[model samples]
Target: MREVFQAELKSIGDELIQMSKLVAEAMERAYASFETADTDIAQEVIAADQRIDYLQNSLDERAIDVLALQGPVASDLRMIVGSLRMSASLERMGDLARHIAQLTRLRYPNQVAPARLVDTFKEMARLDIKIAHKVTQLLETRDLTIASEIIALNTSVDKLHASVFRAVAEAEWAESAPVTADATLTSRYFERYADHGVSVARKVNYLVTGEWDPELSAALDQD
Candidate 1:
């Protein structure tokens, strides 16, 4: 029974890795859509989202069965919990990527963002790729230190997002908003995507340390 449960846990890990690859590719496709204005690729991204959702649900069911049948404890407990967290984050990342692709499809060849703002948004997308890559690495290595590093980068992404908002507001106030809206919206989508990456990294940290970082909660503080 223990052996079977262990095998089930390993299967869950495999599925999560597969799911991450799909979601990561979906993100890459989202950015590619922006550059190429390729509605076909964008629609592909939109369509792939269902696969992510289904995988998460399927993984959850197997994970739950393992827990119920074998009653995992100690490290097994941690791995199962972590796998669940990772799947949820990956699922949300897929949703974010799908949204960006949908938004691109809705308004293509129409100057989505101001030239300068679009450039900044492009940078944001590159960062999204970085963050997604890091999330995959952390999962494979289970390196809490690397997870911490990724979490720190999230602050940098947040700063960039804030800067984007300020830039968009200035453009609007200057009566040059028409070209900047797409850029602003794109940056927002990338920011949220980075957020999901940070979330997955923290869950990896949980697998290693059994505790969530305090600084992330601090980031939520407004006072």
Candidate 2:
């Protein structure tokens, strides 16, 4: 029975790893579409989100089955619960990527962001891609250090988001309201994407250590 349970846990973990990688790829392609006004890439990211959603739903069912049959205790129980929440965070990250892609689709043949802010948006996209990969690593290795690194990376995304707001608010700002709205919303989507990555890492930390990090808890509380 113990051997069977271990196998089941490994299967769920593997699925989680796969989901994170797919989301990371989606983030990459979505940004590429945004940067180059590639409608095809945007549509690919949008279409891929459905697969991530299906994985999350399937993971949830398996997790509940484990809880029902195995009656997991202590860390085993934590792993089950944490996997469910982490899957949720991953799903949300995919949604954010889809939103970015949708923005690209909506403004195809023309850039989604203003000309001046294109570089900043590019940097935001790059950071999210990095964060997504880190989450995938953390899922496999359960390295708490990566979790801290993810939080630090999220801080960078938050700073970039703030810069977008500042640029839009400046007196010298000359972009149209629609352009400004796109910039604001795009920045927001990237920031939220990073936040979900951090959230998943935190859940993994809790699953391993069996105790919540005070800092992570406080940060999540603010969210």
Candidate 3:
């Protein structure tokens, strides 16, 4: 029974890493499409979202199977349950990327944002990718030291989110200016994407160390 449980856990872990990679890539491509104003890239991002959704469902099934058959208890149980939660987070990340892609598709042949803002969006995408990479590392190391750093990184993400939203809230672009709308939506997308990455990290911390930090919620006044 224990061996089966371990195998199941390993399988779930592998899936999480793969899902993380896919979601990160989606964010990259979606934002790249926005940067280049390329409809083809946007369409690709939209289509890839379906695959990410399928992966999330499969992960959920494997997690449920583990819980039912293994009856995972204590830390093992936490790990199994957290897998489902993290899967949801990863799926949401993909959804945000898809939203960006859809925005690109809806507003083609028009500048969606200032050239300067394109750099900003790319920066946000980089942040998303970085956080995903960090979470993957945390999963393997289960190092409390690394987990503590994530809380600080989440702070940086929160600041970026606030800055982006505030900038958009104050801006005024004409209705025909798809660039402004796209910029606003892209900023929001990155914010939500970063939030999901933080969620994944928090779940990992809770599972490995039995401590759930509320850094993200606290940073956003969510609770």
lDDT of each: 0.78, 0.90, 0.76
Least well predicted 10-residue stretch by lDDT in candidate 2:
214-223
Model 2 C-alpha lDDT per residue in residues 43-148, reported as the tens digit of each score = 9999999999999999999999999999999878888888998999999999999999999999888899888898999999999999999999999898899999
| lDDT digits (tens) for residues 1-223 of candidate 3 | 7788788899989988888888878888887887777899999999999998999899899898888887878887878788889889999989998888888778787546675566666677778777777767777677766655655666666677666656666646234445556666777777778778777777776776576566534543251
Prediction RMSDs, each to the true structure: 2.4, 1.2, 2.6
- Superposed Cα deviation of residue 1, candidate 3 (Å): 3.2
Candidates 2 and 3, the one with greater TM-score: 2
Residue-wise C-alpha lDDT for candidate 1, range 1-223, written one tens digit per residue: 8688768987998888788788889999987986778899899999989999999999999988988889888988888988888899889889989988987788886545555566767777777777787877777788777666776677777878888778756634452455456566677788888887877776767667777777654442122
Q: What is the lDDT of residue 83 in candidate 1?
A: 86
Error of 2 at 206 (Å): 1.2
Residue 193 lDDT in model 1? 82
Best by lDDT: 2
Which residue pairs does candidate 2 place in steric collision? none
Q: Assess the local accuracy of residue 7 in candidate 1 as a C-alpha lDDT between 0 and 100.
A: 82
